[model samples]
Target: MQQTKEQYNTGTATAKQPSHEADQSKTQRLRDKKVGDLMVNKRRLVEVPYTATLAHTMNALVANKVLAVPVAAPPGQWIGAGGSMIVEADKQTGTVRKHYIGLATMLDILAHIAGTEDQLMDEGVNDGFDLDQKMSVPVSTIIGQCLEGLSLWTLNPNTSIVDCMEVFSKGIHRALVPVDSHMDNVAGVELVESASSYRMLTQMDVLKFLKEHASSGSELDGILSRTVSDLGVVTERVFAITDRTKVIDAIKCMRIALLNAVPIVRSSDADNEEDHKQLVNGFGREVIGTFSATDLRGCHFATLKTWLPMSALDYTETVFANPLLASIASNTAGPTSRELVVCQSDTPLGQVIDKVVTKQVHRVWVVDQQGLLKGLISLTDIIRVTRFAIVAEPNP
Candidate 1:
């Protein structure tokens, strides 16, 4: 999935600038900041229990306006305790501990529902089941069916701002910093329990920190001079699906790739005579739009609940056929898809940051001159680069 150096060079490139001595002091100050200073406090953390239903989890996310929430194991449930659970315990105290099992993002839930519907549609012929029956299943079962071995990235409380930048530079959006836990009395026994606290550090937080703390005009110039291509956070392999592909399939692709959204392209032969035939047969691939977790909001679970009884093919076709579904799709020319912000590979780091903050978008797609998808630059990527600039080797 790696793009060649040639591919990178083809896009508009930003020129390097000479650093000025006046900016040295401001850069050093930013470098000295700790990630803990910017982290959201644990006590105010919004989380869901591991046992929560899919509907409940979705509601929680929608209510909180967050993309993901931590899934914590129920207290007293330890691995090998006649249930499949993972936890940490003190050997000497012989006490069970509660722990964060994983994170459930909006994408994860969408993927599970979409994938499960696809599977059910396939199996529905042999096993006759109504939509209500299928929809009533537990979220735990869907998670087990759709996602296994999901790993979460975490950060320590003392992590330096520079180090935090490194993680974001790798294209990760958020990291959880676990608050230290102490012994507590549970069931009349003093035992170490999973820390119920975590601080979520997001790219926005980091960016806001830099914006507020930047001391001089030259400091902003110094930070913005870095090129996006040089940051090393953009994904090498791009993941996209054709416009005619099922929305569920798009969700599955994003889930598998851990992407926030997958570009919706026209069929590969869209420009050829065969392209018309494919489009007639529902195979147009001109990068018509993008499907992201945010799109899920347009279709309420309550609506899905009502549509569950229809055959999978009928359900998918009818649901996606709606123009509302296309609202979030980012296309080059459509009125709705125009909302998708985009840039070239050679876009400057600062310009990307300005667009992100001003537009309030999570990411911007990198496209070639021909309008073909190249890579993606996210707020996390920009934050990572900014962090690096503040802490580069010659700190004053």
Candidate 2:
């Protein structure tokens, strides 16, 4: 049947069209927001100068709870105090020229001065040494050697929660350094915790996951894989090595990566050469021993050194993944498992739980008196046990 517009009643039905303004608004909400929109300004920033004493720097760190600080050189002028240290015979004059050396950090000063208080005192430096004298060197001297460059990764203020999921998936530290597009000195920063998504998840979303999956009670003893802290696995003895080592020298890789411990197996034997000045593996490469960052940390000199052991920083190598452990821990459902938490055997479960909560850690390893691993308890184990208790309740 042929029908006219009037016969089809097309005139009576008006098609609803999407409001362009509304769609645009939605699109804008998801677009990358600029760091300038959300970064905390410099007035609120924590800044330490190159001349800052170790005592003052540590105080600032403790007060602000920050590990790294940008140290800039104090603008200085060239002085011809005694003319240049060099003698230009033809010119009959020496000129001391000054140039900007860039930034330095606490890590820098420590490297220049190694050894602990006792060692330094034994060497006649005295206890309660004056930090000003010890760390007074120009910031430029440490540049490239220690504090050459700093990188900052920024996300827009309006970036969606889904987009940031992967950023927080690992222990990348929620605090982000803020800077201009030119990558100049930092202007401000946006702490990851300040994002709206974090709050949204905390109040509206996390509880839902917990209600569905988490257990009400804690489980101190749970089955899990052996970790570096495990007894079967060795701890303590470690040898530090450079990153550029042969594949056959996997132990060297372990040392550089700062694992618990490793054997320093050479890639090839150096028996053929008489001088043996250079040790080479079978693959014609130098091999070194396996080393752990922990070994360095144990040394009294580590803390005083400008380049402190990586272990001193409060960062998790692993993150939470399976909020429910009995089922999905080993699968792709939970956080990335890398950092392992170690504690003494007599330490209370409450303390362990505190570490899990504050550090956002995934598992806890209880160690015996000899620093050997006892067992592990995953956050999932705690949640699963709690979940079972909650679900088994009779019609409450």
Candidate 3:
């Protein structure tokens, strides 16, 4: 008995489709969506000024509840400014209307406050933490100082989803999409700007969009249905800290590893004798909670005044002590607290996507049935998988 042409077309043709053509087909099916589709509520500028004092900057961040903000430079404030500084130009004016020099994060401020630069005060070497002086430092002074590797990417509203995925897949955590520009939908991004025209585009934004499209489009169904373990997206090599770790230690570890956040585990099977005796490995550990730079959102000018006149050692010991969870709990007046996001390795990729999108978390910790963390799946991993669609076993 021979198979009929219709039966072969329905079954064999789809299964045997060339992976290259299939990937291209998947890209084509969802390319219609544009960056502009992601909503920008109003045209008002939401960025912090380059000249704004860290005191004002901290307040702005806490008030806005944003982890980071774009540091916009006015044309005249280029005195002793480092680098060309103008990374992007307006499409309409062909000149920068409000130049965004670099980005500033809460981590940058907290790191500097914690003596990252460690300089002697003018009064005396022992007179540490000139709180007033430190708080009054301009935003421009520390914009690009603390986290040197942090980058800012610009995307036009006309950019395609595939291109955006490629950009994000390269491990870029932040991007600015210049909205209110008359878009010409070519394959490339051309950012147009007017006075006070700017908007943030996060990986979550695109991931949510992709999820919506993947739910409707049949092309991604086969890929999305696979387990994360099969997709090889779970990163086994991860950095984390224990709940017993101090707040200052957490900040220091995160800073050294160039990590924005780290998981709070109960224990770590780490050797203390290693030269690089900082980072806590959470593999097979019990994850309690997580800490990130954003958790320092509550520490601002008003809050700093209460802890005035404390030495660096005393300040750290008093505030940055053990049981990291209680020190930064939301109910208290110190930080915005922590969140725990987790999933099993065998969980479906589609379900993982749903979990991340719904929770609005940066990554999901991969755990065993007994609730021990095995690995993690970050947005970069998801984007990499989506960009390549490679199906392979998790690396050993």
Candidate 4:
């Protein structure tokens, strides 16, 4: 439980800046900072060879605990990116010490596995997809299948934070920030850069930056200081499940909804909970856990022999006995495990940003003071606020 601070420590850090920058407005200060500022103290890029298999790439991502990575091609090699989602390479254009093949992720791997032949229940027919052959293919083919809605953006060090916010707000989850890169402009885009080094900046990075600076009388302090309800981010149309819900059933629900995660509750009684219609504050909230798409990352292809059938149109009855919370214990140490985090409607928007970033989650369930679910605050919501408050706000 986080104890509410008596007051936000706002407007204190401004005095510490250099005298020349002391009088800058929030917009000017943001414009002065570049995308590269987010890369400060960040590790150099983590990459896999262009020829890496899906299994090898998955191992690299698990070891690094990263969700996505840029596939690297050897120097002077133009990657043949036929099925790739992020490859924007044109042979006559850019050169680099190491060329980027494309970005790959755990979700892409999962999405591929989900489509395995006979992955659906065929009313007891036994023919199934060959998970082994599927795992043996090159990983680059699968990297961006799940991110069709997002544009894979490549940004230079000099691009402003204001521009980056607009990018993320438009549904691009991450950007590849090239370091020490140079390229020629062709067809309205920079064709190449000497970018052997790269850093991936994500929505989390921006959220962390805002969490640290927004309340210090930064441009967004006014909006961030408002209660979450005031910001209209406490969405009421959220889908949730009970602690007793079967694990397989829960996963299917989220998968169908295309949700990264769903909130879990302990209370079965509807009368005691907040109304989905009114959006009013109430007590006795009982959010006990969360089930995320990431949790299934631990399911190896071999293990999916049993896991996939239960996900079919006619799921297995036996697996229904496995409760979601009961399974959480074994997963706490895995890549998919997450903590149960909740907040009230009146919680400051800045505080929600802190929780979402610090907890490494995309959404934070908004509970009544008593800890049951009412609505949710997702990274998209927070980013939308940042877009309106900082990127679109008028200067003082």
lDDT of each: 0.54, 0.31, 0.63, 0.59
TM-score of 1: 0.66
On a 0 to 1 TM-score scale, where does candidate 4 land against the true structure? 0.69
Ranking by TM-score: 3, 4, 1, 2
TM-score result, candidate 3: 0.72
Across residues 27-122, which tens digit of lDDT does each residue of candidate 3 receive?
344545566655434234467778899888888776665667888777646532234243334666657556666778887886666555423222
Where's the lowest-lDDT run of ten residues in candidate 2? 195-204
> Which residue segments of model 2 deviate by more than 4 Å?
1-43, 50-56, 72-109, 115-132, 138-151, 160-354, 359-371, 374-396
How would you encode candidate 2's per-residue C-alpha lDDT over 183-265 as one tens digit per residue?
Answer: 23323322211111111111112112222222222121121111323322222222322322322122223322322332222
Write the residue-wise lDDT of candidate 1 on 20-87 in tens digits.
43334334355555665665332366777667877777777766656777676755552311132333
What's the count of clashing pairs in each model shown?
A: 11, 24, 0, 9
Q: Candidate 4's residue-wise lDDT over 169-268, tens digit each?
A: 6666777776555442311112234454567788888877666555354577688778999888777767765544544455545445556666665544
RMSD of each: 10.9, 20.2, 10.1, 8.2
Highest lDDT, which number? Answer: 3
Show where candidate 1 strays beyond 4 Å: 1-28, 40-43, 79-98, 116-135, 142-149, 178-196, 211-220, 229-236, 268-286, 305-338, 379-384
For model 4, where is the 10-residue window of minimal lDDT? Answer: 1-10
The C-alpha TM-scores of every prediction are: 0.66, 0.32, 0.72, 0.69
Clashes of 2: 24
